[model samples]
Target: MVDLRLERVCEEASKLFISKGYARTQINYIANAAGISVGSIYTLFTSKKAIFDFVLKCIIDGNYMGNNMALPIKESDFASLDGEILNVCKELSENFEKHILDGDDSYDFKQMISDVFDIISRYGVAFLIFQSNGSDSGVLYAYYVQFRKLFCENVEKYVYNFMEKGEIRRCEFPEHHARLILETLSWWGMHVKYDAFETNTGISQDVSKNVAMDALLHAYTI
Candidate 1:
């Protein structure tokens, strides 16, 4: 089991990294936020980079329990890293599956869209970190790209399933529709809340999700 103090360190470090950017965030800041000593932090993580990597992995896999953060994986452990990436993909696929529509009606489509938005909202901070170009973490970015592809593929499958069910109109470009849906959700559920610029429209999550659902349903419904 992971130590509670270690978990607190990772959580505080992640928040600081997100707020201050990776380069500007310091180990001391994390120590202060986590109420731990700098030496204690080093006992858990070899360096700042290691802590960042651990936080990134935890965020991507939604492992808030800090199970992954407890034991730091070695940098040379490519196989272990691949396994972690696969776990992230599996977690994302399960979330997408939960939102797949099962009925042939606008209400079903709307609920699916809302659920998708909620999923994105739950992972909003992680997505923001993934999109940050200021960070030099190429490995994290690559894993994020893989996760995005997996998510879009599952969304495409849902689109095809809905089309076959006669819930949505047949389209020649299901991939395009899936991309549009993902982009819409990402912007409304994530960017609007976390982007550096003034992108907030003062719209509630329900209003934004409802508007997006209405637009999508109108465009694709029979």
Candidate 2:
């Protein structure tokens, strides 16, 4: 079972880090947002940076519970973590969009849409943090740009190839449609839950995937 305080801390920290940027988000803010005391926050994290590091690890590791995790990650652990973060993001960015390009016999538009949704749903929060806090996190921001460019290029490739094959509908500009599709997936997968101005649709992640994919398939499928 996930520790209640740890889960709350990670959730609130991720939200605050994305919305408020790393420098502005303090332990107290995370604690307040998490409905825990400032002292309680320290018990869970040695410092704000530790919390940030822990959040990044959880996002990448998908192990929010800290099951088998060392509690209260130390500053010593932060050493070399930035490189680790970049490496993980780099590998995923390099490989994820390739999931769409499995030759003609295996290509499936619905499956392609699922792959897009899965990647964004799984990794988009980290991307949002990288985007929103570019000033404080130049390294992550630069990496975020590369990650986005790589994914966009792959999407464009898939669109152009399938269009040439007469599978999915062809657009005047496959690049634009690639971005459009990405925006749709981003909104449903990540932004809807985080955008402060967005009205609550109470849509679960599974429902979001289905709705977004079905809509995209309707618009793009031949």
**Most lDDT-accurate candidate:** 2
TM-score of each: 0.60, 0.90
Q: After aligning candidate 1 to the native by TM-score, how far in Å is the CA of 134 from where it should be?
A: 8.8
RMSD of candidates 1 onward, in order: 5.7, 2.1
Q: Positional deviation of 193 in candidate 2, in angstroms?
A: 1.0
lDDT for predicted candidate 1 compared with the true structure: 0.70
Candidate 2 regions exceeding 4 Å error are 69-71, 97-104
**How many clashes in each structure?**
0, 0
Model 2 scores worst on lDDT over the 10 consecutive residues at 96-105
Q: For candidate 1, give the lDDT of residue 80.
A: 59
Model 2, 38-155: lDDT tens digits are 9877777788878877777778777545575566656676677678788987787667655554454476667766888888888877887888888866677787788788888887
User: Model 1, poorest ten-residue lDDT window?
Assistant: 70-79
